[model samples]
Target: MKKNKKNFETKFWAGFEAGNPFEASDALFDFAHLDYYKRNLTQAVIYSFKEEICSNNTPSEIFIFYKAIGSFLKIYYSLHKKSSKWKVKEPVRTEDVFHLTSLTKEEYDNPFTVFQKAFAETAFKDFEFFLAEIINLSLSPCKEDWNIDLMSPYIHLIKMLDAGELMRERGLEKIKK
Candidate 1:
């Protein structure tokens, strides 16, 4: 309801014009609302999730992730109320955020739900930003946007599931030589 602490909308647009939307510190995590992102990133994110879970998780593991995903969506949706001061490129409705992955904000995911398992065991913050970036790609207003595919965010994300794993993989690699 109140103005965002920072004028992130202006900053995001400015950053986009300057190149590197994700590189900016001021962009809000406002991707779910973009129509372009919904069409494009949805499948990419789905693929990335499947790739991540294959090694260590049962097909059934995603069932547990749904609960967490639903909770975060509710928080995301509420932040963009009609009265909010943030600028909007495209107006969003409650239905705009819908997906097979999202049955309801308060509803629980079925055990076998694809998204539930991937999301359940995953870190919420990365997933949130990851989704936001996906949305940004989908909603890019013009040409010359970042080459990020909806699926690519998950590649990094899968690796991000565990801090120790990331630290060891990159941290050790960087330190190795």
Candidate 2:
């Protein structure tokens, strides 16, 4: 089979980051890849729990959302093989991104599926709605809904990203305290 050669490293996303939702520039979007995807997701989760949804979230609740975001990033990585890069660059319908509804027990796992379902529903509804759904799920994920385990190594990656960002912005004292 002849490999198709084309520019794929420049895929774009809305460049969501922690605290602020979108970047302030005329270009608008940011490139999409594993790291950016994870960061945007982490930011989305952070946005969800920051001040509006609830300020009293437990550490476990925050972990669940991070785990969920990590799981989705894995799914995206599995489907897309393009190398990760940052540039500036979406035509597919939203439903196409949410096509995990038919996976079986062997294919798809539990809490991750729950998160994915919530994400699919909220993804197109603007940041406010998206964060609301994420916060709700983070607060009370229906663990009974799925039978598979709910942990991924990506959770650690996300934690590192967030922690690094925190350390850079607020220093280690604030992160530890």
Top model by TM-score, which number?
1
Report lDDT per candidate. Answer: 0.32, 0.33
Number of backbone-clashing residue pairs for each candidate, in the order shown: 8, 0
User: By TM-score, how accurate is candidate 1?
Assistant: 0.24
What is the per-residue lDDT of model 1 for residues 31-120, given as tens digits with 9 covering 90 to 100? 222233233334434444342322213433232233223333333223212112322122233453333233333222111122333445
After superposition, the stretches of candidate 2 with alpha carbons farther than 4 Å from their true spots are 1-80, 84-136, 141-146, 153-177
Query: Which numbered prediction scores highest in lDDT against the true structure?
Result: 2
Stretches of candidate 1 off by over 4 Å are 1-4, 7-10, 14-34, 46-101, 105-124, 128-177
lDDT of 2 by residue, 1-177 (tens): 975433212212222322211121111122223355355455545544344333344565444444434333333332222212211111123233233333334223222233334334333223333434554544453422433222232243343233222222221111121
Using all chains and alpha carbons, the TM-scores for the candidates as numbered come to 0.24, 0.21
lDDT value, residue 100 of candidate 1: 27
